[model samples]
Target: MRQLLQRLNNNSLYVIISLLIFGKGLGFCLNRKFFFYPPQFAWLMNNVFLDYSMMIAGIGLLVYVCLPSNNNFVLGVLLAIITVLLAIITCIEIEHVIFAGEIEFVQNAISNSAIIGFILWTARHYSKR
Candidate 1:
């Protein structure tokens, strides 16, 4: 019974992580329209590489999460990659606010930070198992 419960918990965690990755990926794909049209986000408008990289990373992470494995090292590496990407994005948003005097991107930065926190928490949860 304890083993069954543990399996259920792990499965649920995977599902939650998968959902978050999918939502974030979809948001990245859809937000291109908004980023392109907005003058405040002009810096990101021409950066197609960054946009594509984000989508690819999301897909890769989702695939990794779906795989049946108990390897913490691989998970940690993936999380680190994601953290770096998000940090880069957050820094860009902060730069926009500082240079353009726009506070709109601050919300994005906050959201990114929250996601990072959630990822860390998820990693810690898995490490305990």
Candidate 2:
């Protein structure tokens, strides 16, 4: 059961992240025609900024996991934790978006993607060590 759960965790996480990013993209695409409001625009802008930041961090994480560096497992783990926390906080802000028009799908996508990416990256890198 534990092993099965671990396996599913990555898959589900991936789905969640895809959904979140998709939602955000959809929101940006539809903001003008569908949800034309200042708050919505601001939310989308904030979401984009946050995602860009996360993308940079995500790249660093990729390098950290893929490279044969020294014992940076602690740092790697910390980064993953931080990403998870960001996802949670982002989700709250996105909840309002969803209430307005189900744009929170992007949050789910972002969170799931980050979670799965970090977990698999860490597991593969560490297990090899």
Best by TM-score: 1
Give the clash count for each candidate: 0, 10
What's the TM-score of every candidate structure? 0.68, 0.42
Off by over 4 Å in 2: 1-48, 72-74, 85-94, 101-128
How accurate locally is residue 43 in candidate 2, as Cα lDDT from 0 to 100?
58
| lDDT (10s digit) by residue, model 2, range 14-111 | 33433444444445444444332346465554455555445545444444434444455654563555456455545654664566565745666575
Model 2 residue 71 lDDT score: 58
Sliding window of 10 residues with minimal summed lDDT for model 2: 13-22
lDDT of 1 by residue, 1-129 (tens): 676556546556544554565566566666665443347566654465665666666666656655655677776776677667777777777777777667898898899888878877877765524
Full-model lDDT, candidate 1: 0.65
Clashes of 2: 10
The root-mean-square deviation over C-alpha atoms between each candidate and the true structure, in angstroms, is: 4.4, 9.1
Model 1 clash count equals 0
Error of 1 at 33 (Å): 4.7
